[model samples]
Target: MQDPVEIGPYPRKPPVTIVDWAMLVLAIVSVIYLAWITFWHVSDDIHRTIVYVDYGVCAIFAIEFCWRWRREGWGWRFPVRNWYEVLGMIPVTNPAFRGFRLLRIVVVLARLGRAADRAVGDRVTAAVVNKFVNTIVDVIKRPITVAMLDEVADVLQHGRYTTNIANALEENRAELDAMILERIRKDPQAGRLKFVPFHDDIVRIATDTTFRIVFQVLEDPRTDELVSDLVRENLDQIKESVREKDIVRRPGATR
Candidate 1:
């Protein structure tokens, strides 16, 4: 039998297990600790005592990142999108600024919820660990995104894209065709034109949807007012021009 091809870190989705439980606990602790830091502000004495504890939790995430990278086998890329987690590893002597912590409450809670959802593994997307952490994380990542875009542009210039594309198409062709056929069959509006080809269906749907939108806009009172104003302006101009012509022309001359 042919071995499965390894594409990246998560070759296949991992099942929920004790590790997920541990990660969930760590996340809960992190949220509580952050809340304490946010509302009450950790003092120097307490910060010194729990400093290693903070480092230890951050270390676990850092190791997880490395573990995932190593598991990628041959096909691997740097986890640039996860740049936020690195902030967690940085040991701060003082609590983060009060204003920032207040802002991060929603972000931190949102990530914690994602972690919880992952543990449950329902109809939601699978995720683990904190979404790399911090309110400032978003603001600083625009430049990184640009840099990543540059890497993409660079790869497009040199990567074995056509070979990869051919292999992907070859592997998924049956499933892709099935998906197209299924979508066409399932589409309520397209069912009427069941005889239409896939491309034709797409074109018909887009054209019909856009045509309906245009008609709706034309029927709108705002559009009606705009057209009315435009017509009135043109009629007024035409009337003024005719009145001028009448004043200048001889009484018997053809206007």
Candidate 2:
């Protein structure tokens, strides 16, 4: 649907996505802070500071959630549908549910992966996305708590899920062709450019091949294992470090 919100001359798309660098940075901060609180023992002063900072993050997320809720006409179902952002808003000061921000990472990663697929090859794009995701998750691995990356991956990569999308395109094929022809004729460079009739088979082949390549990457079984291993490795390393620290602090031990 076209955005109802009007710019000077045209309608812009709604702000359904909130994945900018500023928000991503805040999320990374939120996730790291959440991890620190979850995995490491902190002094009261440090804990208070974390609460102070996260309170701000929580307020921002809440405002965004409400804005989207109103704009999308999601009504009561908005919170249920957007439960991830809701998690970040549900008392960032409390620290128990501050992981909402990291969903930003998943959003960006998934989007970037798709964009890369359009810009380059599909298998190469998937491999790059998996590596990048592993690196970020690995960095936050020490505090990484979620275990269902595969679940989200499954949601993105269901088999034959784009059948409806292709059907819709096919249904509107004539309208799409007319719109393209009109735009081509109206272009300032129209004199230099000839309008070529868009073939129905062209649309079918393009959509089918694009979806196939993208889903092939998403359906990879190894994604789940890679995510699991990163979390496991980080936790083990943190646990060992804590044990060593405890031993050094023990009484009657050599300096």
What tens digits encode model 1's per-residue C-alpha lDDT throughout 1-255?
Answer: 999965532322343456656666776776667666556767777766665676687678668657765665424344443334445444442345333443455545544553454455431322333344343454444434444444444444444433454466657756765666577668998666766567655755665565456556655666655654665565556556655654555356764
lDDT of 2 by residue, 113-155 (tens): 3333333432344465456966755556543333344334344
> Clashing pairs in model 1?
84-132, 85-132
Per-residue lDDT for 145 in model 2?
Answer: 34
Model 1 residue 174 CA deviation in Å: 81
Q: Which consecutive 10 residues in model 1 have the weakest lDDT in total?
A: 122-131
Q: How many residue pairs of model 1 clash at the backbone?
A: 2
User: In model 2, where do residues sit more than 4 Å from their true spots?
Assistant: 1-19, 92-255
- Best-fitting candidate, scored by TM-score: 1
In Å, residue 201's CA in model 2 sits off its true spot by 99
Q: Rate the local accuracy (lDDT) of all candidates.
A: 0.54, 0.53
Clashes of 2: 0
